[model samples]
Target: MAQITLRYIPFKTDVAFLQIKQTEVSGIPLYIIFFYIHVYSAIFVLLAGFTQFNSYLLKKRPTIHRNIGRLYVFTILFFSAPSGLFIGVFANGGFYSQISFVTLSILWFYFTLKGFTSIKNQNITQHKAFMMRSFALTFSAITLRLWKIILVNLFHPAPMDVYQIIAWLGWLPNLIIIEYYLYKQSKK
Candidate 1:
């Protein structure tokens, strides 16, 4: 009995490992390409935002801030959100994952548009609020990848399962952070 159980254990482990390997290998090249694009765009947006924000905080350089901010928002709105949304549709797992991606895409557009509109109307406070929200979604690519790593390590779930959790896992924390930031801003 003991020998049988041990034998099965290794078999199960090997099967699981094979499953992961198979999925990773067979997944489309487009999937990998989109994944890379999503991650790089997030990094680009974050770096641009950090640079402009730091300049504003230290030197109060409005011109530099405005120029970088334009580039930042453009990246988020035009490049990041669309690619994310496309990738979200192709996201593995199932319908809930798809819904999460769709929701994320809408929120991305909404907050970004709000920020742009607020800026046009000279509403700095609102602009900041919306920009924070937009940035939160932009950061989701990073969060999603991190969550996938964690979930897979912990549960060794299937690729679809990981993808589903990642669909929600990626952006949910970002939204929470945005709420916290907005709350802090309001407190001040």
Candidate 2:
């Protein structure tokens, strides 16, 4: 993920994914700004998320876990989610894709915030459930791209069709898996 994100460094608006978003970059006055904000802040969120699920960190270095968890939650709430929500409005693939992205941003914010508040309230079970859901959503950042590659390789669908599909595919399966896991945990 870091490797993928590095492309945006020494930023240029005409590179990689932005190459396709030129129309948005040109027309949606704040699109470029929010795009960069989402791009930059998302790395931190992903990195913070990577550290948060380590059992060793949680057991032996809880302070580190807590700090990183806070970083993940706060960054999502303040930076990534808002920027995502903004950019999602002008998301590629038109209205349905826009709805999917916007819904994703809103749900991401809700789950992350719920996890944070649950932890603060010392509701460990609730926190774990919500954080699992939150992390699944975070994982969408990777899954989205991976799905795009696989779909393009195997099926060669139109770019916008792929975009529209991935807008939901990116996160839906992750959320479902997490929900299923949570249900099993509850059963136990």
Candidate 3:
């Protein structure tokens, strides 16, 4: 993921993913801005979020957990989620994919916010649950691209067509799996 992201470094317009998005880059003035914001801030989210789940770090180094957790929460709230919504509005695959991405941004923001508030209120269980939900959505960035590749290879569908399917498929299943795990954990 970091490798995929690093291709955009120094911020050139005619590069990597931007090569395919020329239409959006030229047409929508804010598209490039939001796209860059989403791309840059997402790396931080992935890094901080990964550390936040380390049991050893959480137990023996709670201060580290809280610090990285703050990075995850604030980055999502201030940068990632908002920029995601902006780009999602003009996403490929038309309204279907647009709606899916937009919904994802909203849920991602809501879950992360709830997680942060839960911890602030000293509700560890709720914090865990909400952060789980938030991270599930965060993982969608990778899953969405993976789904696109798989769909393209298997069905040879148009790029936008595959994107429409993946926009929902990517995050929904992740959230479902996490929810199931959370459910079973609660039962235990």
Candidate 4:
């Protein structure tokens, strides 16, 4: 009986270890790799953009602001936006994911352009304000990922189903938040 018990113990231990390994390998590596890049880059841009905005607001340093803003816009407009759009299109979900990304692209363009035009017209205040909204939207990339996580855990464990809603979930909430804040600022 003791010999039989010891033999089964090793078998059980091996099976348990194999189960743990399989569970760890359950996630798709390719998706995770791209996601890591997408997430980290988006966060970097958001943090850096906010720092530049704060500097402009407090010091009113046009030179530093303009330079930083230019860098920010270039990064978002060219690199971040394009990459996001691509990932959005290839997103594990379907129509929802596509629409969400398309919306992000448009808003990013519109707000950024408005900010640029405002600056051209020598309307620094308006430019700054509009740019704030644009950058907020840009930062939505991060929010979208977060929403995807919550939705996956709560409503849809499948990436595809969650992907569908997250397309809208990502930016729409951010926009709503922007609107709400703008409204509050107006009241003040």
Candidate 5:
């Protein structure tokens, strides 16, 4: 996430600094702004989410946990998810990629909202379940990059083709695995 931030910080001045060439050509200033917000807030989401799951911190200093949780939710709801939805329509790899991103953005927002409301209702188990779902979606940022590297570098698939696959692969597996884990935990 830090690497992405460092790479993108210069993009404010130089559109050439953009990693995705397609983004440069599409170059609507509004889209650029939203994309920047999405990327930046995503980093915060990742950072805030890291501490959120720390059992020791959560148990010992729940106030801190709640604070960070609030940050995470706010970042996603106000910045990340909305920007993501805006940028998603212009995502590369055509309609498939666009659909994947749009759906992911919506689901990310939905799960995070559900988690927040569950906690507000004092339903800890439901809150945790929804949060797990939300974070699984959040982790797609990492997974997407990883899949890109592997698919592009190793197999040398066409970038658009690999992107189409990774768009869904990125979050689907994460969500599936988390659901499985949640199911198992519930059984126990």
Candidate 6:
């Protein structure tokens, strides 16, 4: 994640490095602005959210946990998700990839909101379940890159083909895995 963040820092000045479809978005001022918002906020959300599942942090520093949770929720709702939706429309792999990304963005927002409201309603279990779902989407940023690397090296598919697969593969599997984990945990 830190490496990704560093890679993106250069994009602040040189959006040419964003590459292909993303670079195409650079011409549209609004899209470019939203792209930066999406990237930076997503990074922050990912980092802050990583600590959220730590039992030790929750047990020993509840205030820190709550604060980070608030930051994660706020960042995703206000900045990351909306910008992601915008950028997803211009995603690389035509309609299929666009749909995948847009769907992920919508689910990410919905799950986060549900999690927030669940906790507000004092439904801790529901809150945890919804948040697990939300973070699974958040972790898509990482999984996308990992899948891209694997697919590119292993199959050497065309850029669009790889993008198409990773677009759906990224978040969908994460959500499925998290749901399975949550179900098993509930049984316990």
Candidate 2 — which pairs collide? none
Tens digits of lDDT, candidate 3, 1-188: 89878999989888998888899999988889999999999999988988888999999999999999998999999999999999999888899999999999999999999999999999999999999999999999889889888898899998888878999999999999999999999999
Query: Total clashing residue pairs per candidate?
Result: 0, 0, 0, 0, 0, 0
58-130 per-residue lDDT for model 4 (tens digits)? 4876677677677777667666666666555555466767777866877787787788789889997788778
lDDT of 5 by residue, 4-81 (tens): 787776666344335564554366768778878987899999999988999998899999999999999999999999
In model 5, where do residues sit more than 4 Å from their true spots?
11-27
lDDT of 6 by residue, 1-188 (tens): 77666776766545443666455565676877778899789889998889999999889998999999999999999999999999899888899999999999999999999999999999999999999999999999999999999999999999899989999999999999999999999899
Scanning candidate 3 in windows of ten residues, the lowest lDDT window is 12-21
CA deviation > 4 Å runs, candidate 6: 10-17
Task: Give the lDDT ranking, best first.
Answer: 3, 2, 6, 5, 1, 4
lDDT of 6 at 16: 41
Residue 136 accuracy (lDDT) in model 2: 93
TM-scores for every predicted model = 0.73, 0.97, 0.97, 0.68, 0.93, 0.93
Best by the lDDT measure = 3
* CA shift of 16, model 2, Å: 0.9
Model 2: runs farther than 4 Å from truth? Answer: none
Model 5 lDDT, full chain set: 0.89
How far residue 96's Cα lies from its native spot in candidate 4, in Å, is 1.9
lDDT of each: 0.72, 0.92, 0.94, 0.65, 0.89, 0.90
